[model samples]
Target: MPANLPAEAKAKWLRVMEARTPQEKLEALKDFLSSVPKHKGTAKLRAQIRHKIAVLRREIEERKRKRGKRGPKFFIRKSGMAQAVLVGLTNSGKSTLLKYLTNANPSIAERPFETKLPIPGMLQYGDLSIQLVEAPALIEGASKGAMWGLQVLTLAKNADVIILVIDLSYDPLYQLKVIVSELSDAGILLSPKKFEVRVERRRGCGITILGLDPMECKKLGNLLNDLGISDVIVKVSGEASAEDVVNAILGYQHKPALVLATKYDVSRDNFNKLEGACRELRLKAYPFSPQIPRENLKRELCRAIMKALNLILVYVKTPGSTPIPVTLNEGSIVLDLIEKVLGNRILGEVKYVKVWSNRFKFNPQKLGLKSPLGDGDLVEIAI
Candidate 1:
C-alpha cells in the first residue's frame, strides 16, 4: 500500500495474494519480504510480512507433522477419575510413593533412575479411583533433549495434574526451581490460571473475534496481519498478553500442578525451607512419609490431588442398589451428570431427578436439569 514500494516487491506481493497453498503463499511472502526496501516508513509493513511468513510456515509444518504415524508406545491411554503423573529427581522416593499410594510394584532401590520407564498405578480414594504414573527423573538441561527428558515431560504434560515429588532431605527449593524451569523451557505452564485467548484459523474468511475489546482486536489484527493470518476466529476469555496470543497461535498446553514434598521426617529445617519456597512460588505443597499410616497417607494424598484438580465426587444412587461414586468437573450440573451416568439414548428417557446434599440433610429434594451439583452430592434419576 505504500507508494514508495519497489516494482519487484509489488510483483511478489501479488504472487502472495494469488497463492493458494500455505507453502506457495509462504514462498511468495518470503520473496516479497526479501525484495522489499528496509526503511523507517516501511518498518511496520516489513514486520507484517515476516509475521505472515512465520504463520504460513507453521501451517505447512503442522500439516507435514500430522502426516506422520501416531503410536501407543510413547503415549499412555488415560483412565480412572483423573490421571496424575509423579515427577521428581533421582532417588526422591518416587517409586516408594507409587507403591504406597497405589498397587504399583515398581522396584524400590537406593540407586538413582531405578524406574526407567513410566509405570502406571490406580489409586483408590473415598470410592474414587485416580490413575497415577511414575515418570523418569527430571534433571537440568532436560529441555535441550538431555536423557529422555523431553519424553518424560511430554507424558507429564498430558496428565491432569503433575505431582511434583521433591526430597526434603536435600535442597528441595533448588530442586523445585529446576523442575519448574525445565518445564517452562519445554513450553509447559504449571499455573491453574487459564489464558483468555483462543484462535481458530478458517480458510477464505477474514478475522472474526469475540470477547476481545476494540483496542485488543486492533492490536491482535496488527499482529495477525504481520503473520499474514487473515482468516481466523479468535476468542479471548480473560485479560491476555501478547505472549499468550503467540502461544495460542502455536498451541501450547497449560496444565495445573502441585508439589508433593517427600520424607517429611528427614529434616524439619529443610522442610520448613521447602514450605517457604513453595509459598514464594505460589505452589501448594503436601508432605508425606512412610512413617504415617498407609491408609491415612493414601487418603490424604488422593484428597490433596483431587482438590488441586478442582473436581467433584458425586454419588449416584439407585432405588435397590448401593450408592456409586462419580467424578465430574467442578461446577457440573444435573444435565451433565445425566449424560455421564446414562447414555444420550437414556438421557431422553429420564423424566425427573432427585438430589440430596449436606445442606439439605441428605433428604431427597427435586432438582431441575439445570441445577448445579456440588461435591459429594447425591442424585437419583427416574425414567
Candidate 2:
C-alpha cells in the first residue's frame, strides 16, 4: 500500500514478489529492506519487505534444523577425476548433451524440467572416464532451497567443473549473469586463485590442450581468465589439433572447458555470433547439432566429456546373491544411490535399501536385527 517508492526499490520489490524460490525472494527482500526509503509514504512497503524477510528467515531456519537432525549429507567420492556438472535453464539441451556424451539416455524432450532428478553418466577415455552429472534447472531463488535448488547447489559444489549450457537464441550474457548470481547466492566463491594450475610435462611433451584454431585459442584464453586463470599463457599453434587442445586443457591441473553450442543447424549466423561472443569472453566454443546421426553426436559428446572431466574408468564386478553394500561418497542421498545401483531397472519388489552409516545407528531391537548371526550381522530383507 506504500506509495512513491524509488525506481530501484520498486524493482527490488518486484523481484522479491516474482522470485521463483524462497531464497531468491529472501535476497530480494533484503535488498528492498536496505534500499527502500523508510519515510512516511513508504512505511508500508518497508514493513512488507521486512515481513517477507522474517518469513523467509523462519522457513530457512526450519529447514536447517531439520537437515541438522539428519546430520551431514553424502557427497560423491572424489576419485581425482574432474567432476563436471551440465547446468542450464530447463530444456536447454542439457539432457541431450548428456545422452550424446555418456549415452546416459536421460529423458529428452522439448518441454522444460523434463530432467527432475540428477542423472550421472561417465565418458570413457581409454582407461579413464570422467563423471558427468546433469543438474536440474537452476532458476532464481535456487539458493534458499526452491524446487530442488539445494540439490542443484549440492551437486555443483561437489563438482570440479561446471558446463553452463545456454540457449544461443537468447542473450548469452543474460544467461551467464543469471547462473553467476545463483552460484553467488549459494555461497560458491569464484576466485582467480582457484583458476591457477601448474602446467606439467607429460612424456617429455610440452602439453598444450588449447584449441589450435586462432578463434578457439583466443576463446580458451578468455574462458580461463573468466574462471580465474590469470598467469597462464594460452597460445594457439596452427599445428595443434582440436584433440590436442582438448588434451592440454584436461591435462592441465586447472583445466578450462569449452562452451558447447547446441542446435548449430538452427542458424549459421547465430553460431558465428556465439563463437564471436566466446572469443570476446576468452573461452573456447564448439558448435554441435544433436539432430545429426546419434552415433556421430555421441562420439563428439564423448570427446567433449573426456576433455571436461579427467576421468579414468575402472569396472568392478561383484558376484554374490547378497546385495553388495556400496559406500558412496558422504552426502549422497539414498535416492541417488538407489538409482546408481539399479540403473534403469524398474523399482519393483525392492522398494528401498537400508543404509547403515555412523549417522544412522540402527537399534537391533527396533529393526529386529539385534540377533547376531554366526558371522558379522544379519539383515532381514523386506520387499
Best candidate (score: lDDT): 1
Looking at model 1, the pairs that clash are 48-226, 51-227, 52-226, 52-227, 52-228, 196-237, 196-238
The count of backbone overlaps in candidate 1 is: 7
Model 1 scores a TM of 0.75
The TM-score of candidate 2 is: 0.45
Write down the TM-score of every candidate: 0.75, 0.45
* C-alpha local distance difference test of each model: 0.77, 0.55
- Report the C-alpha displacement of residue 286, candidate 2, in angstroms: 2.1
The prediction achieving the highest TM-score against the true structure is: 1
Per-residue lDDT of model 2, residues 276-375, tens digit only: 7667644556766666776665456555554444332212122325543332332334343444555535445544343333333563321222221211
Worst 10 residues of 2 by lDDT: 368-377
